[model samples]
Target chain A: MKAETRRLTRKSDHTRQRILDAAASTLANRGYAGTSIKAIADSIDMQDASLYYHFESKDALVLEVLRTGVVLSEEAVNAAVSALGEQPDPIDALRAAIVAHAEAVLGMGDYPRANVRNFGQLPQEIVSAQMSHQRRYGKVWRNLIEAAMASGRLRQDMNTRAMRMLILGALNWAPEWYKPRGELSPGDVGRQMAAMIIEGLLATGAAQPVRRQKQGNGR
Target chain B: MKAETRRLTRKSDHTRQRILDAAASTLANRGYAGTSIKAIADSIDMQDASLYYHFESKDALVLEVLRTGVVLSEEAVNAAVSALGEQPDPIDALRAAIVAHAEAVLGMGDYPRANVRNFGQLPQEIVSAQMSHQRRYGKVWRNLIEAAMASGRLRQDMNTRAMRMLILGALNWAPEWYKPRGELSPGDVGRQMAAMIIEGLLATGAAQPVRRQKQGNGR
Candidate 1:
């Protein structure tokens, strides 16, 4: 390839990264309907036409931004669980996954944060386009949770799917209350969550809190 | 009072309720930026000028909707705890509060769900107007957590604030994924959450999950 062509490719890649950064930050703060291609371009001081030159449409750009969020979160969680090495305790792996996810959404930068902030408000087309990445990420959690349940550490009576949703629900909501300068770090929040959700808030040997009649674990 | 005067007051109150109902459903689905007075009036087949006559402004209307959300959540939680009778176990009270909040946000109606959905995206002035209600609601949880801690049944090392945030965060995010047609009712979600959070996932007498070095709770 010609040196000039290579240089142009590098410049194009740089412009793409810059556009993504702007979109992530704007989407993080402004949410879906509030964010626009024109505003993103304005933030980066680029012409709207130039912005469109890189990305075909607003949904395309925002979808990429959101997709990156799932990628980063999945990577963080996978890495955390892998760091525990072969045959790690299932509960420990679960803890690590929780902490890593909390950190990713809370402190890992605006991409994941943008996803957490704007996920529920996206248009149907964007949600559909983003579903593959989200499904893959959901599979990652599904494996961790299933491993834990199979290990017989988690109570067999509980629904594994509800467990996964409740855990992620808590972690994802961290960005809503987590302050960059607050007294607790993201990891602190994660550990506290892990403690409550896994170890529970009850002291050792405490009587089981009263429960309604036991029902079959709607498998 | 004259019968004619009393009838006019009833009619005014009826229209006011109709406007609020329109606002709640729109805000629940469209979010803060997507919801507008005109759209709300359109939903209920009222004129835009008539909406203004009822709400004065968008912020005023949205604030009232969000404030109603907090009130409903608080009332449900309070009622649940009170039903436990005097001197109930702290954990039991917490469980009740959790389930009640889940029901309110998930099944009661759209007002609380609207607050949960659009909260983080709302403008500053509206958030400010809504703060007092939110604070009071926060206090409800604070008192419950404090009582649990004081009872010596909870792990003293955990941050109460984080615990409260994590619990409510999980419950509030229920609307994003909850399906009315799904097998689990709102009460079922709440019960599962309470079970995991209060009693934990660990089998009886399982070793504590690994943690970083113990630091004093950031009181």
Candidate 2:
């Protein structure tokens, strides 16, 4: 009985994965509006009825795609955070987190694009689910910001909520323009972004001597 | 003859304006895929054929909508830059430019959303035209960054291209989550973003003080 149950579970998981892969590809290529049930079915070499058997509706299929993307993104963030466990320097950890998150998203390529483009097409329940996951993601950054603040490495005056929003806004939207072929790797872009936000454009006291000299002369 | 020509031009302009207004509202509410020529025409109480007379197709209508939004955005940025005329503080001028740009896009609301959401639907020629306008838009930020660098207000080592991308990325995508009813006004959000990027997370020279205090306590 136990062996039979294990076999059934594996088969179910494989079928679900196949359905999701088919949906992601169709949604990416044809877009939400351009894609239909029949097209997704044709791509997977399944009948339209079979596709329905897996997903109740087109919206359900899209919802599943979004859920999967968010889950994958969350997992990547969690892994990066775990890798930085007990690190005294929150800034370094945060930077690592940013780079890892960018790689995970860009690594998926068209999958991320489809997720963004079809965001509005998601049902209200699915939108809420994604938002819940996002809130969890936000907490990860917030905790890092708070940790940095506690360490005296970061400014006390900075609003952590706003800071998180700015960082996430910049990072989340990066795939829109960031090409892997560019001079900057995902890691480079991530570090530069982290530096710009963490160290800032202004010449702080810790700024190198040359930069400080320039600031002094300007004053 | 000149007066007759002016009259004809004025009539044509009015018709064009009408089509754009209808398109913006329709596209914003119904989305790109959901909007149709008949709907836009009906919004103006014109026949579908009449809308066709003005626009070659639904694609053309969307293209005009995008074109007009870009032109208006550029005009707003130019007007803001002009207003800053001869300001000695490039940082202040840059802040004003960012604020103006954010307000302009926020003011357009649905129009800008339509432009972003419908980008893939645009004809190749139209897409190139729109991108040209974007390149011009980018110059406004690039000029400000260069000016700030020359003024010594910003760090010399900062990559202006990346900085421009960061600033524009934050501001250009504001319509996605920025709410007028939120804690920050559009201008406030712009100012905070600029401050965070330009001034950085730490107070000037505060890092050293904190570090020295910790060392003194240890001793």
Candidate 3:
């Protein structure tokens, strides 16, 4: 009886995964406000009633889709980090993680794209869940940045939050202009992005803010 | 007779500006696919038919709105550049341009927001026109980055296009997370972003591409 239950659970999980894939594509193409439950169900050739057995409502389904996007995104970043192995240079790990992240978010995938596109349109309940996921993602990057700083591989006095945002912001915006066959692939763009950010943060000499002080107004 | 014609033209231009402002807000909120001529006209308390007198079609109206966005964006960049005055430092000019851009994009205004939101969904003719405007915007940024490089203020080997994209991409993405009452204002965010990017590219002594080489693959 236990074996039979385990089999059933596996099948159910497979079906849920299938639904998420279909929903992500639909949501990416049509957005939150334009997509309907009927359309999502139709994409998977599943009945609306059956879909409800798995998901309580459209919001429930969308929330899962967003969760999947964040999960997949984290997995890519992890893979990039793992490539560094034990005792890796923190700055190098950051570059690999950022490049993988750029590829995952900017390449031919629907989940991350949908998350960035429909973030503003999701229902309140779903939004809370997405925001929590986003916060977790932010923390991961912050830790990487802190590790880099601790290792003296980057500027020691940098603000992690601002630096993380600047890096992720550029990566997230890649889909806006990232042509598949264009001169730069997502990976190439990622490397370039990582280089530029890391170069700026190098503490060749102890860094200071570069904003020009008004000569006449010096107090 | 010439004076009378000039007065009529001024009145017509005023009405056109009014229509574009309404359309920009509507499009920003509802997106290009979700918005309609009737919606924009309703926003301004004007009939859809009369709206046609000012814009030949929805495409024409959207095109004009985009033009206004580009023009306003250029003006903001120009203001930032002018602040540096004659004999400006390249890095300082870049910083000022980025800060101004961040404020314009992430501020209370809706035209630039509408442009980014509705860019993909615009009609083909409108998109072609938008592309040209975008290209011009790219040139302005490229010029700043190139000037920085020429002055040895930034890394000489870095691709100007990539650097420009990284700077502009982060600035453009600010609207996603920039809260008016947040810890940092849009201008402040812009400055931080500039410092981050510019710092990464500083040509101090020797620099290395911050990427991890695969272990056991000794070069």
Candidate 4:
């Protein structure tokens, strides 16, 4: 390729990344309905036409930002679990995934945070566009939970679907209250949550030990 | 009071309720930014001026709806716990509160769901105005958790604050995926969540049980 063409391509890619960064931060702070293309362009000091040069429309740009969010979080979870070598304990892998997810959404950057914040407030078309990414991410957690259950360590009496939702719900809600400068790090929060979820709040062998015979499909 | 005056007062109150109902459903579905005063007025076929007469502005209208949401959930939790009567088991009371909260947010109506959905997207001033009610509601859970802990039946090593936040997060996130017509009722979701939280996901006497000695406030 010609030297000038190569330079132009690099500059264009940089511009696209800048636009995405701005869009992500906007979407993270203000939700989907609150973000606008004009505001995004203005934040980056780019003309609307130039912004459109990179992306077709507001939905398309937001779609890419959200898609990146899911990818980033899924990658974070996969990396954390993979870091635990071959045939690691399923419970430890689950804990690592939880911490990685918390860090991704809380400390890593705005892309994952945007996905966490906007899950329920998107247009039907946007939700449809993001469904596959979300489904794939869901599968990641499902597998983690299933692996733990298969190890015969996790309880079998509860509904696994509800368990997954509850775990993700707790982790996803971190962005609402997590402050980077606060006393607790994302990992700290995740560890505490994982402990509470694994051991529960009940004191073992205490008064009112309510354990019962395993019930069928308790949901 | 005169009968004519009383009749007019009743009619005004009824109209006020109609406006609030429309506002709650719209806010729950569309979120704060997506909901407009004009759209809310149009939905109920009320003039914009009439809406303004009932609520000074969009923020004022939304503020009332969210206020009702917190109040309803708090009341539900309070009533559920109160039904246990004096000297009831703290764990039982906590379970009742959880079930009531889930029912309020999931099955009762849109007001609580609106509060759950729009919590992170509200403007600063609205958040400020609602802080007292939220704080009061927080205190209710804190007291319940404290009661459970005092009974020496709950874990002493975990952070109580994190425990409350995780429980609320899991419950509050129900609006995102809970279908009213689905197989699980609100009470069922709450019961399953309570069971998972109180007993945890660990199988009793399973491999890799990670119980530890009492440690310093493990935040």
* Strongest candidate by DockQ: 4
Give TM-scores of chain A for all candidates.
Answer: 0.87, 0.74, 0.77, 0.87
Candidate 4 ranges beyond 4 A from true positions? A1-8, A47-49, A205-219, B1-8, B205-219
Model 2: per-residue lDDT, tens digit, B56-150?
Answer: 67777777787766666777666877786666478777767776766666665556656655545444566786788767766777887898878
Write the residue-wise lDDT of candidate 1 on B5-75 in tens digits.
45345557788888988899988988888887889989889888877666667888888889998999899
Model 2 chain A weakest 10-residue run by lDDT: A210-219
Docking band of candidate 1 = acceptable
Question: Of the true interface contacts, what fraction does each candidate have?
Answer: 0.64, 0.38, 0.40, 0.67
C-alpha positional error of residue A40 in candidate 4 after TM-score superposition, expressed in Å: 2.3
Write down the C-alpha DockQ for each prediction: 0.33, 0.25, 0.21, 0.36
TM-score: which is higher, 1 or 3? Answer: 1
Candidate that would win on lDDT: 4
Per-residue lDDT tens digits for candidate 4, residues B128-195, read 99999999999999999999988888887766788798889999988887776767778778888888
Badly placed stretches (over 4 Å) of model 1 are A1-8, A205-219, B1-8, B205-219
Q: Runs in model 2 with CA error above 4 Å?
A: A1-19, A25-31, A38-50, A117-126, A146-158, A203-219, B1-19, B29-31, B38-50, B117-125, B147-153, B156-158, B203-219
Question: On residues A1-219, what C-alpha lDDT tens digit does candidate 2 reach at each position?
Answer: 332345445555666677778788776545566667887778767888776555667777777786677667667777877886665467777767776666655565455556655555444565785787657766777897788777776656556766676776667666667766666666567667767766677644555421211110100
For every candidate in turn, the CA RMSD to the true structure comes to 9.4, 9.8, 11.6, 9.1
Candidate 4 local Cα displacement, residue A44, angstroms? 2.9
Docking class of 3: incorrect
